[model samples]
Target: MNITTLSILQQEYPKLMEDGIIQSNVPLKEHCSFQIGGPAEVFCTPYTQNQLLDLLRFCLNHKTPYFILGKGSNLLISDKGLSGIVISTERFTELTVEQEYITASCGVTLKDLCNYACENGLSGLEFASGIPGSVGGAVFMNAGAYNYEIKDVLHSSVCILPTWESINSLSPILYLKVEEHNFSYRHSVLQDKELIHLSSVFHLKRDNSETIKRRMDEYQQKRQQKQPLELPSAGSVFRRPEGFYTGRLIEDCGLKGFRIGDAAISEKHCGFIVNLGSATAKDVLQLIQHIQEVVYEHYNVKLQTEIRFLGEM
Candidate 1:
């Protein structure tokens, strides 16, 4: 079940901790760009799929709750801390290029992937260059900007599917075709299934490195100008509602720069809620709730959070 406790893991995998793959009482703020989470009771980083599979099996069997941590860009963990083990995919960074295809492991950053593609004279991922997320997180969310999404260039993916019955073969390893992803705006099949993405293949067309770099630089410049890059935030707090821009709505509601303790709506960008030194999860939650209430009352639009919250508020 992987959702009960983690004592057995610590006892059985003592060597893993000694090898630096497992840790205890790890502060999650250090891992995420938001710098707002408390601590994780247990934390693990497995370098290979085999190791990950073994850990997964153990967790599933032992009913120890575990949360996957990828990039940590879009999360708002609890100030009270999380009780379960956190499995970080940061070390799963194997990347390769073969002709028009680029294969990257789960932990590969979008920036590195884009740069690698550019270096190889490949194009199509330039729009993802400035995104602060890992490949797995990006794919899981079908993350996109500038009218391009991961679904556009995704060729295939390797993942693990957990089901009670036979899933084509005895092995859990699956090669998911792009057509089977069921992708939509900011969502992928992974969000609806108990699947773990291991790696992916992206198809890109040939292009001049200079041209690709220029496009990438243009996008990065836009992000720096429009977003609150100087502040600690979990990117945009709300998903853009149809026919309405979230940031604009918040700004129109006179809620920009609103504060709840150390958590405040970014003065530069209304969509973001930034942590202004020693902000707690409680503060962010209160701020988010206030924003939602105020926006709904003013514009009849219920702001839905894009950021994933974990643990107790």
Candidate 2:
């Protein structure tokens, strides 16, 4: 951003500065699972709903671009760096359980949510036990595993609809029921609309604690056995194409173990692209492009990435 805008933010949002909740020129590599990314011009982590609203209002009023960051498990940030502010909801970690329902903030990790459910003898979230992402990120992508998705258990969500009028009026908050979200395979209404997820309520079933634990353990074991868990990766690189399993198709194309720079298609799991130490964002991008080209040439099916790419490529 320009100096004028920066000065305006620093002057107007003094609480953020005083609390050290906002920082300048923060590196993003450490925050994401891939361990790759350049710096963010500005980074802010709001601790409460009011603080979050203030931050959003300031950005909207100033017409400054901002991106919401979750666990960063399914993200690829450009090496050139992001130009505007990055709002991380890591501080919004509140979680509560009441009867068969569990409410979790956007920052709560999927693992933590699953563990909490298991501890409370709630089933349904066992399938997400091994997914590496925050609750908001999962809900944003309608994250799924083993044929179970977030939509299956989602009851409702609290969101901020950053529509043009809402941003101008500073009236962004919205409470949406499950049907309103329009969840589908690797997608949700949030993907298309200018909606920011705040928290989610999941409706589950009462189950034996031991049974929940057993199911969670089984899923984790399966993930470890099948995925390249030992290395740094952004999980599955591509969405499943219709009538074709992504991994099997890549393996059939002999793309497994293929490398560009330090990024490689995982031999253990062909669907994944692993950061084999010192991998750059460029390396991963090139590898992905190469995979798409070769896979299309051989199998005649185009692959779409499941992970989100931020900043300029």
Candidate 3:
């Protein structure tokens, strides 16, 4: 932010500091699974959903730029850093179980959600057990694995819209049903809508905890065997193109294990790009562009990224 904007932020939202919800120059790498990113100019982790809404309202009223961060698994942030408030939902770890249903907050990890479901004897979240992202992000992207998806069991999502763009008259919050999500492969209504996911409800079925655990463990084992889980990296780098497997194509082009700085494709799985210690965001970005170029030239199939990019490069 410029001097004027920084001054305005300090003058207008001194309460953020008092509430212990704000910090300055916080390192982004410390919070993400990739272990890559520069610093955020303003960082906030609201302890409560109400506080998050308040923070959003403050930003909207002032026309301040902001970004909402989840577990930061499927993201590639720039090393040059972000220039606005970064509100992390990492603190929103709330979970509940009622019979055959599970309600999970946006900050809750998929691993935790699956564990809770298993504990409750709820089957159907096993597919998400191995995903590294948080509930909000998963729901936003309709994250799935092993031929199963969040759309299969999601009952509804509680989303909060800013009052300025409110759809409800009495309250800005929305209880969006699963069908309203319009879920498809790696897509959701949340992608097109301006709403913040507060929580989600999953309609699962009763099952033996042992059975659920077995399924979860099986999926986890498969992920560990095929994915580059030992390294610091975002999951899959590219979406599977029609009639083509992304990993096979990259491997065919002989780009597997190719390195650019500390960034390199995983020899184990050509689909993933791993950090070979001290990789910068620029390195990863450059490597990703190179892979896309190579793969597209060879197969005439453009590789679309399954991951999201943030900040300035």
What's the lDDT for all of these models? Answer: 0.88, 0.91, 0.88
What TM-score against the true fold does each predicted structure earn?
A: 0.95, 0.97, 0.95
What C-alpha lDDT does candidate 3 achieve relative to the native structure? 0.88
- Model 3 agreement with the true structure over 1-313: per-residue lDDT tens digits: 3455456666776776678888788889987888999888888898886678767777777777888899999889889778878999998999998888899999999999999999989999999999998999999989989989999999999998765555323477889999999899999988887578999999999999999999999998998889889999889988879899899999999998999999999999999999999999999999989999998898888999998899887
Candidate 1, residues 94-163, lDDT tens digits: the string is 9999999999999999999999999999999999999899999999999999999999999999988854
Per-residue lDDT of candidate 2, residues 113-198 (tens digit): 99999899999999998999999999999999999999999999999987556755656788999999999999999898968899
Find the 10 residues in a row with the least total lDDT in model 3: 161-170
Model 1 pairs in collision: 1-60, 2-64, 3-64, 3-65, 4-63
Q: How accurate is candidate 1 locally (lDDT)?
A: 0.88
Give the poorly placed runs of model 1, Cα more than 4 Å off. 1-7, 163-170
Candidate number that wins on lDDT, 2 or 3: 2
Full candidate order by TM-score, most accurate first: 2, 3, 1
Decoy 1 TM-score against native: 0.95
Query: Which residue pairs overlap in candidate 3's backbone?
Result: none
* Residue 264 lDDT (model 2): 94
